[model samples]
Target: MAKYKQLFLMGLLLAIVSCEQPSPPATAEAGKVAFNITSYLQQQRQMLETRQPMVLKSVATQGQEPEVVETPDIDWEDELAVFEQADLSRPSLQEFYTRQEQVLEDGSTAIEFTKLEGANPQVQYLRLVMSPEGKLKQLHARLEDKNIIFFSRRTINLSTNPQTGDIADYHVEGVQKMVLGDTLRYEVKANL
Candidate 1:
């Protein structure tokens, strides 16, 4: 019967529509970001393994994500507290790298960066603090002396060699905050 045939076709259509797969979270734009993050991570790991002072990155991030997306919340001051307790007497420099961890959606992620031995002089180091959604909370960088400086730019990022003044394209607010010693603490937020 025509009525039965129509019902069968409708059911088939519904089934097909419902079978469609959801889009991947890692889109083309996100893919580019993932590539950059992976590259940075690899380079950081290499530096840690080799005990090298990473060339200061000139900028922060270059992402394809829409500018309107909500910036994730971060508590940079607390993040900095961790580095304050950094163990200077650790046997190897990489030991500092190993102590770094960031919370991801599923579990947690570890970030690596290059640190020069006594050449840089500050015992404390920089590391990435993260939110549960894999967004960066704060950025940690080493200062030449035994102190670290931080700024309260809630939704900003920096990418330049403060000492050398080499400019890199970092998408952030340019408000400087004083952090003494050899560590530089930055509050990296999701928003601009």
Candidate 2:
């Protein structure tokens, strides 16, 4: 009985530590950059919730004809909902630092984050570039298995509404190669 109670308490503690919620930024630039990520995620989530229609173009790496599907016919909300959750506070991001101050010709900054130790699936690193006002301009992420041959990378470039700082159009490109399988490549471009 005592052992059972101790085990339950330990499990609860682990869950609490693992589920730490994200906090807002502490500095002006950091806050703006973080806010951009949060806002973009929230917008994506809202789009999913509202079931906004989109045209998705998918093609194989072997140069097959792209398959264009208008989204209301095939619900893609379940897939896009995942991106709505992208935030600076995800457990996978650790030791974020300002790697470069002038990533853009206009004197914007780029922040880099090292993957957390023992992070599941192993992310190599993540980078976010932002405008002076803290609007996100681009994001890049790489994932790799050092012990094996699997590797993947994703990049997102966004254009925002100057007045609202909301994403106006964005492009996402990614490539993945599994340890025991063929490589896959995909790209998405959407405007709002």
Candidate 3:
């Protein structure tokens, strides 16, 4: 009788353990998010091929005083090519497979990726914000190069026409620190 009671308890424990829910495949979901972001960027690239040049302002400062100097407008005709040349490669995409996805309070979605495997292995993070329909809305990236003790950040915000799905306007801001012992900052805002 005692042996039978022990067997019953073991069976109950096994049943409860088997009924527990399993975790979702995070990597696969992250990959899907990354693919969506890449597709949206590709669409933007195609649109940029036919758009006119954009206006930009640049500034630079050195040392700790943080003097802000605003420069005149500059034509940014080659920025699209620069973005394309980055070549969202396979390894970089793999990094996104480990990212986290969340929905913001404003009903937008955000995907964030971090690569801090080592002190010098591109200690960086990429955050992408998109609309519910998967349109790219904003992108922010921070990258650190430990070898040279350099840091850089880029922020881009875009608005699109609801009916036509065309870009209405965009603003881009960038900063680089300790780049060959100099600091630089730039901002670009354009209307389509």
For every model shown, the clashing-pair count is: 16, 0, 0
Instruction: Show model 3 residue runs off by greater than 4 Å.
Output: 1-27, 30-33, 36-42, 49-77, 81-92, 105-107, 117-123, 145-165, 168-181
RMSD of 3: 9.9
Q: What is the C-alpha RMSD of each candidate to the true structure, in Å?
A: 20.8, 9.7, 9.9
lDDT of 3: 0.56
CA lDDT of each prediction against the hidden true structure: 0.38, 0.57, 0.56
TM-score, candidate number 2: 0.51
User: 89 in model 1: Cα distance from truth in Å?
Assistant: 36
Pairing residues by index, what is the TM-score of model 1?
0.23
Query: What clash pairs does model 3 have?
Result: none
Tens digits of per-residue lDDT, candidate 2, 1-192, equal: 999999999999999999998877675545433434556666755664576545453433435665555454434445443243334554324334332344667777777665455554444555677778877666655544344777766654555565555545555667778889998887766655
Off by over 4 Å in 2: 1-39, 47-60, 70-87, 90-92, 96-98, 103-125, 131-133, 145-151
lDDT of 3 at 99: 66
Q: Tens digit of lDDT per residue, candidate 1, span 1-192?
A: 999999999999999999999877443422122112233434434543454323322223334232333322323334223233332323343433323334456453434344544444343344554434454344444433323444332222333232332222233322344665332233232211
Query: Per-residue lDDT tens digits of candidate 3, residues 38-77?
Result: 4555676566565643533333333334333333232334
- Residue 71 of candidate 1: its Cα lDDT? 21
Better of 1 and 2 by TM-score: 2
